[model samples]
Target: MGRRSSNKQQGGGGSEVAPVRLHIDPERPAPRKLEPAITALRRGHVIVYPTDTGYAFGCAISSPRGIAMLRRLKNMGERDPKPLTMLVGSLADIGRYGHMGNAAFRIVRRLLPGPYTMVVRATSEVPRGMKNKRQEVGVRVPDHPVCALLGELLGEPLLTASVTHFEDEQFELQEPEEILRRHARELSVVVDVGPLWPDPSTVLRFLDDEMEVLREGKGPVPD
Candidate 1:
């Protein structure tokens, strides 16, 4: 049986939802083991899952409730212009949400499925709330099986944000047990694979077929 916790929502009108921790083999996650998480996402609930860079908060891209919860969890204000990153199953998925010009496409094609976040112009499919003031969204194709599988099962991009310590922004939460303890009320599921050391993905922004390094981290910059 899954562990349970109870808490009250801020402002005292509702109860907090307890998150279920699901342990699965990181390398070979069985579909049966992933069903619960998929169900939670489908129901507009947020989840915590491992990615190639680190652990991240994820929900169905179309879930407004889930997106609101994510923004609240991240302490993003209504006017905050930062865009949330979406985890996609493949390069083809990226094209559906982001507009990549020929020059940018050629470069991005070689660096994906790794630790990198690419910011591109958003397509009509992306929700307006998910895009930055510049009309752009961040997208990632992580080189992690769980991420790929989740995207495939969800049948849409998983809107994601890095799971970092609120007090210490530099500190990332890696262990599922620890993550559940901290965010049990805000999440519906915690996908456990084991502990992964903190290393954030490199962020690159593309504008009119030009690439610019916004923040360099795990992924190396190309010449």
Candidate 2:
């Protein structure tokens, strides 16, 4: 069996679709729940859950099967994969995932723990499934307890970010318990820390030569 398992209800032009739900405050240790969440990803499960900024949905970086599952969830048809932005606990922890220079470091230090996603070069350790194919990756530092708790427990940088299964809008599912009830079979576990903001993280991509604002949202990273 592939790493991902899904049980979705399709409502489209004769296409199979998976249901996306929210899990809010379940009866489990935040990290214990995270184990299954990561397990599902390792086994190829695409999930949508809460984040510091809003809700982050994606597969586990360590799982190529999960990456393919996420791609299918995103409906991506490209041959090579493009790196997606991910949330990290802090700047120090991201050393294995992407490259953060002094300038990028200064900028990220100023805007993270608030709401912002920084696009930068990827390190060799970046997953081939998640890297831009050219060694570039987008990274973020979230200032929320659940975000830290999950990272602390997992002991690895999770590729958590705000992405939608459907196009034309950002993927924002804010309820944890509801999500779990709907797709429990699809996921091994769902972490229900608590309610979080209903907003998405702000996006900023740092060019080799300069800084460029990609998408503006809740958290305002300064110049």
Question: Per-residue CA lDDT of candidate 1, range 1-223, in tens?
Answer: 2444454332101245566778878899888789988988998888899888778899899998888889888988656777888998888888899988888888888998899999999999998778888899999999999998998888999999988742355665477778776776778888888888778788899886999998888999966
Error of 1 at 37 (Å): 0.3
lDDT of each: 0.83, 0.58
Candidate 2 lDDT over residue span 113-199, tens digit each = 777777777777777667665567778777766666555665566676453332246545456655555444444444445554467
Weakest ten-residue segment in model 2 by summed lDDT:
11-20
Q: Return the top candidate by lDDT.
A: 1
lDDT for 193 in candidate 2 is 50
Model 1 Cα shift for residue 214 (angstroms): 0.6
Please provide TM-scores, in order, for all candidate models, with all chains considered together.
Answer: 0.91, 0.71
Model 1 TM-score is 0.91
Best by TM-score: 1
Summed backbone clashes in each candidate are 0, 17
TM-score of 2: 0.71
> How many Å off is the CA of 102 in candidate 2?
1.4
Error of 1 at 41 (Å): 0.2
